[model samples]
Target: MANEQTSRKVAIIGTGVIGNGWITRFLANGFDVVAFDPADGAETRARQSIDHAWESVEQLGLHEDASRDRLTFVSSLEEAVLDADLIQENVPERTELKQNVLAEIDQFAKPTAIIGSSTSGIKPTELQEKMKYPERFVVAHPFNPVYLLPLVEIVGGEETTKEFEQQAYAFYESASMKPMIIENEIEGFVADRLMEALWREALHLVNDGIATTEEVDKAITYGAGLRWAQMGPFMTFHLAGGQEGMRHMLKQFGPALKLPWTKLEAPELTEELQERVIAGCETHAGDRSVAELERQRNEFLVKLIDLVEDYWP
Candidate 1:
């Protein structure tokens, strides 16, 4: 499953936030990138994003030949993927649009090219339903600021092969990413569902006036977030069992799973609620611009990843 070429070509089919992020990571790994987005001034915007992010990427350790000169923003989807060896589709999340675009990519991309979707929740089964070569497709979901984060969850559909899964994992690893393959096809995958549940509960708290946004942020960044960075919930719980291990831990706190302390359903997003949420977020953001916040996040995340590697490996 090793890539034979010294520099692979990557095609970004939708140049939105996630697509640009993928481009950033690929270029930092010395991949020749061809991107297509219908929006006006997309090429210039993508170049600016790469320039802004390259400093942090360099801090994280860039490939020897990595350069912004490697990226080529094309005019159409066909033009982007036609000669590419790998395609990362980042279009809108609507079902039909994804299916149609994947079908188009399959038609254009080289037969050997494996296509990956930057979908957060959509299933590979649905996304690959209309593709001619479904085996060459998989979901390569990455968190925001893709150049910084090392986690890329790879999930395959029913038609996807084990070989393709390994190939997909290797492709992301070429960029030095940590790729974890989902053994089974589950809706919302893993991390996203965890996030969705937390978001739903956070929304409930805000809507009920139980906790401010700042409190919610503190509840995480100062608490479970730190533990979750290096160890997952299960392992943490095992340690909490205090020498008895996970079996005993489950017997102790498992009953709380049935408690009514949490609400999973999302609260109604009325205008008033939306305003409250927005105001709270803005209050937390303070005078920091979006770019500034991104830089801060990327820098810290790079350091945190290094720390986690030391702890685990």
Candidate 2:
């Protein structure tokens, strides 16, 4: 379906993994995209990425007007954002770099254009501080494979207006995304914070010699990961309490919270530990290239998403 909202033009400031994913998604949803990246061969790399991901998006379905030809690479940021309805900043994750880039975007983009940052950890307040029109700025954090993942966390800063947030929500929804408006701003937002906690424990498991990287992956891949794919943590646990649901679950397992079964702090990435993790992953990957693994994952996700939609609330 095409976007019903007024935003039909989107500008992407960087052409890295996430930026290219956004381009693919916008094009899939029948939006014209303009991109600007200074690196040599950036255009070539982005085109290749879009080509590679096209098969999966095609499987997911595309709007009648969606086409790779709709994407245009511009020479500068000013040229990219001058006429855009929404500008997505996906530059490097450094705070100073992002702040500087966003300032330039704010200066060049139309005043009514919504400025979104694909920052995973930084709060919207900090990122919007340098923008002249801070009310239009937001932290639009998205997961990896942005085109495939529908959940986008929209966190507002002190300067962000409710009107802009609502417009942002509708804009992403037009692209077939589930835009989650986070009421409070925080580092890492909501989903990343949850993933970071599990990440810390996974690192500890590998560091303590209790499990290899592959083993830890299996623990999730064959276990919690499956359940998480369906109902998520809270609902999964609710079902675990049997007929009574979460109320009974708390009474039965709440005491275990004090058992210290998991570590919250991440282990130091020592040279030896790094090598073990690298070796373990390489061993498990077993000669398949990253591109090949990505292709396999995309195929599985396309099918999984079809099934998951029937179960989503």
Candidate 3:
């Protein structure tokens, strides 16, 4: 049992959507998880979410032998962080709130413990300033449905040492994740910025009445998204040129670059537009409850991963 326990110990300081996802990912990888959240019924919700996520992980054939006996839920942050080898924070995306929470957790966590934040925007430097041992803290941002997605972005803060960042990378790798070390801090890191760019254009198109929400979804899901799942845009274009590759493809399409591209401007979140967007999603989602949608999503993700592993292996 002690040998089984040596994989890693993870403490989650929040039990919201992101926190629940983190717990699922850690537990699915055989890490002992202790979580603390202040919200009413947070523990129950987190447990249910983890159960559902684990069902998905099991369906994906990930870590069949690790039982769920290692999970624990506590009522206090300190209780969760005290003995954790890695403390992953998924608190609200507020600088002050994160600062206060980290300051408190730093008091009790072991000196060698690595602190990681799931913050999508706030830089690690801002969050670490409130910690007594900033050297141990870094940003470990993961995509949603972290249990299935393998990519994690590791970004170091002001006082974070290279050794600490490397450890974070190794930890993520050990969990079977692909960790990308961010060279510097920037708003939304790398992937989110690309997503935001496409999102901005999506909104623009909808506002201009060029396409419906469903149409946009079809445009991607049935088209570019298929290719994107296998290879990114640049690589897809590179393959498009046959033996010519990226250079020839770029040279051929380079002339069209002078044409007016997307303005890349964010649309105003007007009340009408917001309602329309909500209604559009509701229409697209039909009557599926959040849980139902999550299950379907997990199934699709598992299939996608299986296909990729086979094709790319």
Top candidate by lDDT: 2
Sort by TM-score, top down from the best: 2, 3, 1
Q: In terms of TM-score, which candidate is stronger, 1 or 2?
A: 2
Runs of candidate 1 with Cα error greater than 4 angstroms are: 1-7, 264-313
lDDT of 3 by residue, 1-313 (tens): 1123354888999889998888887777778889999999998898888888888878765554355777899988889999999999888999999999988888889999998999998999999997899998989999988888888999999899999999898887777789999989999999898999889889988999999988887788756776666556554555454444444555576555556567643455455754554454445545654455545545766688667556531
The residue ranges of model 2 lying beyond 4 angstroms of the native Cα positions read: 265-313
For each candidate, give its TM-score against the true structure.
Answer: 0.81, 0.84, 0.81
Worst lDDT 10-window in candidate 3: 238-247
Name the TM-score of candidate 3: 0.81
Task: Please list all clashing residue pairs in model 1, or write none if there are none.
Answer: none
Best by TM-score: 2
Supply candidate 3's per-residue lDDT for 297: 45
Task: Give per-residue CA lDDT, model 2, range 174-258, as digits (tens).
Answer: 9889999999987788999899888988999999999999899878765567556645565455556555545555567766666
In candidate 1, residue 159 scores what lDDT? 89
Give candidate 3's whole-model lDDT.
Answer: 0.80
Worst 10 residues of 2 by lDDT: 274-283
Task: Give the winner by TM-score: 2 or 3.
Answer: 2
